[model samples]
Target chain A: MSADLSIVRGKQTLGQRILGFFSRSVVNIILIVVAIFWLIPSVGLFLSSLRTVGDSSSSGWWTIFLEPTRITLENYANLLSNPTITGSFWNTIVIAVPTTILVVLIGSLAGYAFAWMEFPGRDWLLIAVIVLLAVPIQVALIPLAQMFGAIGIFGSVLGVILFHIAFGLPFAIFLMRNFFMQIPSELLEAARLDGASDLRIFFTVVLPLGLPAVASLAIFQFLWTWNDMLVALLFSNSQSQPLTVAIQSQLRQFGANIDVLSTGAFISMIIPLIVFFAFQRYFVQALLAGSQR
Target chain B: MTQTVVTPAARETGRGDADRLSRRSRRRAILIALAFLAPALVILGALVVYPIVYTLVRSLFDASGSTFVGPENYIEMFRRESTFTAIRNNVIWVIVAPVACTVLGLVFAVLMDKIRWSTAFKLIIFMPMAISMLAAGVIFRMMFQESPQLGVVNAGVVAVHDIFVDEAAYPGANIRPDSGFAKISGAIVSDDAVNDGSTVDVPLIGIRADSLPDDVVNAQTAAPARAGEITGTVWLDFVRGGGGVNGVIDSSEAGLEGIRVEAVDNAGNVVASATTDAEGRYTITDLEPGEYVIALPPSNFDQGYQGVSWLGEAFITGVIILSYVWIWAGFAMIMIASGLSAIDRSLQEAARMDGANEWQVFRRITAPLLSPVIVVVFVTLIINVLKIFDLVYVIPPGVSKPAANVIAVEMWTVSFGGGNDQGLGSALALLLLLLVLPSMIINVRRFREERSR
Candidate 1:
């Protein structure tokens, strides 16, 4: 009886161990599968741009590994030489950079005023800006286009840039104000006591401390402006059309020109990828700090 | 610090607070604001504020760029099929896309968070968010190609059938012998035509197959010959062999022989479809009251039934809601997660020691603390949804084909897509502004309240 009981006990222990191992193994496998599922479409998109049009149409992008000889860089080369899309790459940078910088600078200042200063109609003015936030761009386009045309900036790069900056301000202001409010008012008072002018104190104290918020705002505005197509379409002229517009024009309804489309799309998307990665740490930090009271 | 800074400015504009305001200091503030904000304000007022006013005024007028017709546009909008259809599609997009995007994004985020290279995974999933909507639309369009298999998807399906199906398995299959519908080889009969087989025998060989209608034969033969040239067995063999016959299948295949015709009503169908032509929209010809689906052309069968249902308005709501939720969910989750993480660790530890379970502790302690975060997330999501444009314009479902189109897309359609319907567009824009005024007020008021705390 004792011998039989010992054997049964041993078998039960082994069974339990196997169950635990398989359960954990299944979880790890699932995690990996999920990761691959998320990555495959993007990888497919990237690979499709590098392949010849025949191969792209003939098989799934994953099939490239089965016939690696089909890989080609001709698509990218063609895209670069394509006249219709060339200038928009540079135009996007020119537009995104200045707009991002201006939004950061002006937003921080306005945010400071809202956070620390006690003035009449301060709440009212801020409210007005916030209300503007909910107003969809479509509602504003026709009138704004007319207004821009009247002012002679319609269909111009400057006009597009101005629109992005204006739209970007409310969110920027809201975010920066939240950041400034968290700085412990005593710190600002300490800086003021050091005999610094408001300008000096602002440059020295408020600005430096708001770096995370500034960084995140810059990243947000950069992504928003860089990826923007509707605003660019509505406002930009041929000379000032951004990469989104250029990429858009490549899409022919009946014609299947995957070569130029994928290549141009990749080029257009690269800047945002770089910006996102470079400032990624700041994204998490700012999201944690700026979001909460 | 406050005293030291206040002393200089206070003395300079001493009682300037009350009216000791010197021209220099007041002018300085004005100039500074002008330098910093004038451009933005002017641009905003001109582009955003003014257009909205224009849209409002325009919507009240007639289509000829003429005088105020006062809600006539709205009435016409209700009356017009296109406007109503557009509205219906927009609503479907808004309702469906947001929830779908949000649910998918959250599931992805949660699943991805468990992975070792979480950020890398995020970058990949978020890749689509970076690509222009036009590109996505085009890519999906190619993925949905139709018959004859131009698209990869259809090609793949056809390739499977070729590999699996035996050539001789179904000699009596429903497939037509020729390209035309009339020449089907199966036993099925159409309402319009009946077969009356009459044999004409030829003296030299046998009954000639060419004497019959052209639809019955593969439409590649050069011309018909005299009767009694070939036996029935030989003709049947010829039909099967033509496909795999001597290197030239085209030579032996007959054209337009053995033809039949069928007539059916063409009512209740989406006869024509379009893509956004520079203005970013496509509409099918007026569909009858029935289940109709119109996907992007060239690849029609790739996606599942994205059916446009009855009362197109519901579908438009679905689309709008989908887009709204999809775009805003990430922001919502991020805010809520941040809020939850901000809770004091000690409170939880103390509660655990007091025999409180995780659920009780979360409900009692964490819920109250997270309220502020929840509010911000909800408010931001609402305001953002109110203003979002790209997805709405890009992936319009069935309903938004007409009048129920969102204020934003409506304005664009009227001004741009409607071909110089600027006045109507401007008037709609103004109505949109009025619609969003409440959210804006709430956002600003919340900002103040949050700041004070």
Candidate 2:
């Protein structure tokens, strides 16, 4: 009886260890498969960009492995040389930078007002802002384009900038307000007791402590404006069109030079990815904040 | 205005100071609040609120905004076929795309939880989210291009297809006009029948030289018929630079490889059949001495495998949705992964400790805990796909724009994309807003709930 019990006890540990090993392998396989599926299209595009025109038309991106010598930077060089592409790249910068600055400025200010200041109708206004967060940007497009046309800023980078700032405000304000509301009241009271004016308190105390929120807000605004297609499409004219619109015009239904497109797209995507990596910490925090909201 | 001069000492003596100080401070606070809120309000009011209100009012008017249409545009939106198609496509997108993306994300998130390379997996998967929709659209559009030479997907398919059932080498290659054969019921049938011991020469033209398979060799005339076999040479009648005589196997002509030649009797029954070899030579031995119709079936001239016509009218919406999923699935994964990590590990451990299998633990403990986050991601995606103008507007060709049209794309087309009907666009925009409002409300409520948590 004792011998039989010892064998059964040994079998249980062995089974558990085997179960653990099998589960681990299953987990690895699943993750790897999902990873490959996600990577396939992107890898195809990247390899296509690296390929020579002759290679791209003749073979699949997968063949680059068989003959790695076929890879070249000619597509990238040629795309960068195009005057229109250069112009649009500049246009993207001109739009995204200022829009980021304005959103952070206005959001931080209004957030402070709603969170700390004593103002009647504040609660109703905050609710309105929250509701405004849900307003799809499409609802505002036609009228705003007309308004821009009426004001004579239509088809200009400035026109696009103003539109982004206008639309970006609600979410920025919501984020900033929610973030500031979490700041303990004692921090502001301590400043007030030291004779700091409201403006000084805002600039010196709140803004300093809100670096993570600001960084994330800036990253979000920059990405949204930089990656934007529709707003730029509606507002900007040919000369002022951003890279998104520019890359779009390059595409054709039949026989587009996909090599040029691949290069241009990578060029357009790299900056946002850089910005994302630079502020990845803040970016993830912002996503968390956005989800909570 | 009452007792105006009674508080002259209250300002300095701390007598009745509380009331005056409180009232003044209250007024000052309002002024400061307004000062701070002015920029945001102005922009939001002008660009967002004003336009929305303008769109609402404009939606009620006629195309020129000169006539009072009284919701006619709204009603007419439902009345138009293209617009109705757009609404239907939007319904499909809302129903399928989000669920696909959300489910993929949840699965990925749960899978990534047990792996050591979770960060790398997340980065690679989430990488598409970094790309612009315009770019992603371009990538998918190229990948789905119809030609195997152009699209990677078709090339992969063609490669796999070749491994299974062999594809026709001379697809769409047919007999030239006034040639020996006539096309009847899509098969090339010879007008003359031949006896069992006779030799025949069947030459086909009208296929390009480059399309010829590499194994194809110079045409060789058939040898004299043996005792009981009917033999033939099926060679390309056309030659390079057009020097070959019609219906004759010239020295330069390459053989039509792998073509099926059948011998059928008068009552339309196949007696014997043989496929052409490398030199276009074929023979059916031991045949009865009877008249036969030589037929080349239509399978010999089928249009070869072209990859999917992604931008075409039939499949544009699907391709666009696929691109959306490619981008958003990663987003869902990242969001859900964050949510999953926040789940109490001890509960999962306890469940496992209590003899529940991994799947059971996931279904019961993990899923219930992650349900709220999943709902938020799904709702967010629904809201997003509703206003999906950029991809829809960009991906489809000019002819197919109507088929792939979602409401936002329809709105743009009507107002700006040459439709020149702002009133109709505004109505469409308003309809989209109404459609999206519930999801937005749910999202905001979810946000508030999370805050309360």
> Largest TM-score belongs to which candidate?
2
Candidate 2 docks at the CAPRI level of medium
DockQ of predictions, in order shown: 0.33, 0.55
lDDT for model 2, please: 0.83
**Candidate 1 residue runs with Cα over 4 Å from true position:** A1-33, A57-60, A284-293, B1-47, B64-66, B105-117, B144-333, B343-388, B392-407, B434-445, B448-453
In candidate 2, what are the lDDT values of residues A87-106, reduced to their tens digit? 99999999999999999999
Among all windows of ten consecutive residues in candidate 2 chain B, which has the lowest summed lDDT? B1-10
What's model 1's TM-score? 0.68
lDDT at residue B216 of model 2 (Cα atoms): 73
Top lDDT model: 2
Q: Could you give the CAPRI-style class of model 1?
A: acceptable
List pairs with backbone clashes in candidate 2: A293-B447
lDDT of each: 0.57, 0.83
Q: Across residues A1-293, which tens digit of lDDT does each residue of candidate 1 receive?
A: 46754664575567766875676566558756755644543455678788888776655565778888888999988878876677898899889999999988878887777777755466766666666666677766766676788899999998898888878877777788778888988888898788776667678999998888899888877888888888898899888999888777655332466677667777877877677667766655555444311
TM-score of predicted chain B, candidate 1 = 0.53
